[model samples]
Target: MKRSTCDICHFSIKTCVCSYVVSPKLNNKTRIIVLQHPSEVSVTKNTVRLLTLQLTSVEVYVGEKPSDFTVAQQIAKTHHCGLLYPDQNAIAVESMVSNSQTIDTLFVLDGTWKKANKIAMLNPWLNHLKKITFSALPENKYAIRKAEQSYSLSTLEACAYFLECYEKLSAEPLHHLLTGMIHEQTKFMPEDVKKRYFHEDD
Candidate 1:
């Protein structure tokens, strides 16, 4: 598959989309490394790639565990390294704070449930890392895809919501830019898929 920084929504290079690119400057001490499923990288509407484009601190490792301990070691250097997932057994992101004033790292797995699980399990080193769960207020408004009703969320959705809860961050302008992009991409979805996912039942 061909790779272009181009977004399906704006048909513009990823960095050019200022709205999607301008993530709130994370705490300098906090590094976010995203382990994305290779397949997710190719999907036109996926948001992990967008986040990758926007943040310089974020490291995107394309495939399975690296041959050496380099990547895990780098992430471990941070004061904290927590996995981003909603598993009940996982500790809440908020609860992980030993000191709210200090910066820490958050490692997020970006893919479908099964895909994320495989990524986590395949790298045993990652299993020992701290885990951080989150609580969100249900801002599932993006038009590009449907959210799993009970707890599942798209990578973008999870990141945006996490930022909101922890940073008390709100970026209406950025959200507008992202939603507009989503609308642009989903505009061409087949009628059947649109009908199936366009509207969530009340």
Candidate 2:
């Protein structure tokens, strides 16, 4: 028999994260398109799910290639595509942090660094987009999973910063939601990990 799922979060009812959802509506020119690898979708700690639950107008495409995706092709053709990848050619988003110069669409890759690299390499069309990056970002909140790099951030954190940079907006609701979610997900980790994130010394 199949278990019931939460209608909103789409999680198993037992694991429904409705309480931690930070549903804040955004009205901005930028339409965020997330290209997600299949592997990241089932991970409970993944932040893309939280982002979708919290924000509106976020288009998510699941696959490794642009042709395999439904919305990615049309999005690239119609709008100014800005990829939030930290490549050698990527421009720092801080320099373009003005509401005057707007981005029509922003594409974000959701997966490990290796998976994202593989997707971009295979999808040659992605190379044509304007690559953007952020600097001086705060440390990632995910203590449950270790990152390969010191500057690595969860998908939700990246999106939050993106909003702040492009639209002069703040994601306070998202911040609180993520804090609660991180605490709950890292319950099995050592006390130091949780303390490092939540303690006054932090």
TM-score each candidate: 0.73, 0.86
Which regions of candidate 1 are displaced past 4 Å? 1-29, 66-69, 94-103, 146-149, 171-174, 189-193, 200-202
> Which sections of candidate 2 miss by over 4 Å?
1-4, 187-202
- Per-residue CA lDDT of model 1 for 1-202, tens digit only, reads 6445544333445423444444454332356678887877666667765555544456776665555346665667655667786556776655444346433677788777788887877787776666668753465665556554556766766766665555555635346556756766656678788766565562
Quality of model 1 by C-alpha lDDT: 0.62
lDDT of 1 at 143: 52
Worst 10 residues of 2 by lDDT: 21-30
Candidate 1 worst ten-residue window by lDDT: 7-16
lDDT of 2 at 165: 74
- Measured over all alpha carbons after superposition, the RMSD of each candidate to the real structure, in angstroms, is 4.3, 2.8
Task: State which candidate has the highest lDDT.
Answer: 2
True-vs-predicted CA distance for residue 73, candidate 2, Å? 1.5
